[model samples]
Target: MASSLTKDSAAPGTPGSEKTFFGHPRGLATLFMTEMWERFSYYGMKALLPLYLVAPGGLHLNAATATAVYSVYVSLVYLLALPGGWFGDRVWGPRKTVAVAGTVIMLGHLTLALPSSGTFFAGLGLVAIGSGLLKANISTMVGHLYDGPDDPRRDGGFTVFYMGINLGAFAAPLVIGTIGETVDWHLGFALAALGMALGLGQFLIGSRNLAPRSTVVPTPLSAAERATTLRKALIWAGVAAVFYTVVGVSGSYTLNWLLVPLTLAGVVIPVMVLARMKRDKELDGTEQSKLSAYIWFFVAAAVFWMIYDQGGSTLSIFAEASAENSVLGWEFPVSWYQSVNPVLIMALAPVFAWFWLALNKRGNEPSTIVKFSSGLVLVGASFFVFLAPLSIAEGGHKAAAMWLVAIYFVQTVGELTLSPVGLSVTTKMAPAKYASQMMGVWFLAVTAGDATTGLLSIAGVDLNKMGIVALEAALAAVAGVAIYMYRNKVKSLMGDVH
Candidate 1:
């Protein structure tokens, strides 16, 4: 296909001759398609995995057992990103790392097509590792498309990128997850492979555009690229040895213990370095000040993520167990409802982007702090939207479908305001040397949130009725208090984005 994206024929600030869709770059569409397909595979499997493991005709495991397995899978997916991000930075570079990650995911899907617990687990491992490598780096690549830390277009670009993610997620559960749950579990896994195949193909064809990696590569004795290449080989070898011994051999028991120290180190080491960097006279004051704000934003991002990340964990299981999806005498599988959040996201992203920009023009825009606060509040409100249906249900009856849709709608708005904008902020606040690592720090928040969700699930709540209600209520209350207490401080920390 001919490239729809072209350089501005006219000078900077001059209106170009060629038109773009939705008033954004055409390359955004290509990336959108690639991401959409990839997410189709991921969310498709994710939506159905819990049900597949516990359903009557499926793995036939108990709810507790299924949930534990689900938690482990989700936790590993995020946790693995630690090494994935580091390897992308120091060794393979983002582009190659992403490509390799895609290949691994494809293999995972293929392995999932087999009918054995061993194959199922093996597939899950591949998907987890692959997701770890691709997730953070691909977002990093989006930032790389912009020229500088302060580029105004960067936020808009990430919004477009986020939409691509939703487009894939929106379709997956509806089309693929449903098929898998109703038809054949293996068929759904095969469909995931096909989705990855499409993404891998699109990326390979578009490789030239995605070149010029910003992730750090170690310089070596010989000034040439070859010496840098050799050093990277050694780093990856060390990483593989670590994963093999810590996670592979020792099992989940050892994995848990090792992750504690590693995660603590990931967060503490970076902030401590920034503190030292501030005292040095060589750095610009604007730059030094931005660094501090970035740390605060990162802290907030981590907290918000704990609430936001439930979609793939407890929320997925919740949708499977409780949400009613019947209309006109037809029944829909519960997992299919997982599509709602992304669907709402696809519809709302442009509106939120323009809404913020419109407010900015009027000089009444929310600061990044204000936006983050708004996100926190909106997400809390979303959980409460389900309280009514949840309370009304009696016996074995499910909650009304409208409740789930309402929850997703509110959550989508929260995501639109906070998620991509947070990415832009991370890129803007950090200096170049720390750019990729700061992104890792932002994701570490997500990892923390996922881990928290698992802990909450294991809290021995009443799985049938009252337990879910308590969980949602607790989440809402905590989020509201956090936002209220930090509002002024966040606004102050945002400095002058206005």
Candidate 2:
């Protein structure tokens, strides 16, 4: 549901004599709003998914099953971006990919607007494919609009574009979430579709300002090569469709079965790649040592996300089941709690940015490993907020919303602590030849952690509320402590990375 892939990207669109948006580029405004609505679709559904699964009028799935489904769906969404990046770089180019991908996403949401279990599965697949296609390329296109890395407008432009994403994220639950909770879930999905439609339309109109590079494939295929690739892809697609149809007809297939392989893939793919990089004859001693250090950071990042990203799963469930959703005698949807994190990020993220900058200026900043450890500790400690609610809110009583809000705020700070630095550090620490792949490696940490989250729920579905929160808190705290205890050793492995 979150991404480190595009977090550190440049911004703006084609610059020239064209009038700019917010003093950047007109193309930026287009992409910014397009991304905004696309995210609205994504986060809106995220807010509603678990509740809809368990609703009497909905899928009627149990809590653990629904959460697992959500987690796997999220994990796949990120994983597919790897291929998406390749497609944009080699085949369709970023512009065409974005336009087509946006349409697919809209259609997926429209499919979800229908009321059927079969449509639900198909719709999720479409959305995941579309999201994968759009995820990395759109950001790539944003970078293309700039005049390269030295473009002064790049950072500011990306900052504005980033706001678009968070704006959609912050507003989604407040708008679509309320409708889903009070009106109907299908109707909510339809609105998500409409959001994508609006974004796609705007993008089509405004993409004229996009740079020529938008359509340039970094690796183009010749006619015969293209034909061969398409043929093989179609063959594979046909085989998959047949397999799915046969499995569905047998009534022996569960979504869980797909998850087992996917969960393994999330961790395994990165491990295999990192191991290859470590053993590559092309690298020297320093690069190899950095990889060793990176592996430690990778594990830490996975643990951090495993704990932080639970805001939408078990935490959301806790809010729905045990926390108050009313104020001044006016009841609100529990899904609104999902918005708290983004809004806090919007408000406090700048403060964190300035604070870290000031520390750097004063030469008082903590080392990267220490910052990561701090993030782990803080995020883990946020889990303890649930302790009070679990203690006093016995039986059917709901706890105050402020406790959850506090947890989200602290977690946001923890997020700011590690995530912003994690991306840059990974890039800086990787061997020169492995620069790009290191970005993918950074993302794999997120995917692995997210998949692990679902796997744990599937394995520990019977865990009590108290036990669950306690375990999460303890796991993160212990990881943080362990990482801190060996910080000097990790730093040594990092060599000159700092």
**lDDT of all predictions, in order shown?**
0.68, 0.83
Candidate 1 per-residue lDDT, tens place, 302-348, comes to 55666666555555566666666776668887776788787777677
lDDT of 2 by residue, 132-183 (tens): 8998899888888778889888888788888899999999999999999899
Runs of candidate 1 exceeding 4 Å displacement: 1-30, 142-160, 208-300, 431-433, 459-468, 471-475, 492-498
TM-score, candidate number 2: 0.92
Cα displacement (Å) at residue 373, model 2: 1.0
Clashes by residue pair, model 2? none
Residue 449 error for model 2, in Å?
Answer: 1.0
Candidate 1's error at 493, in angstroms?
A: 4.5
Q: Which regions of candidate 2 deviate over 4 angstroms?
A: 1-16, 222-251, 393-396
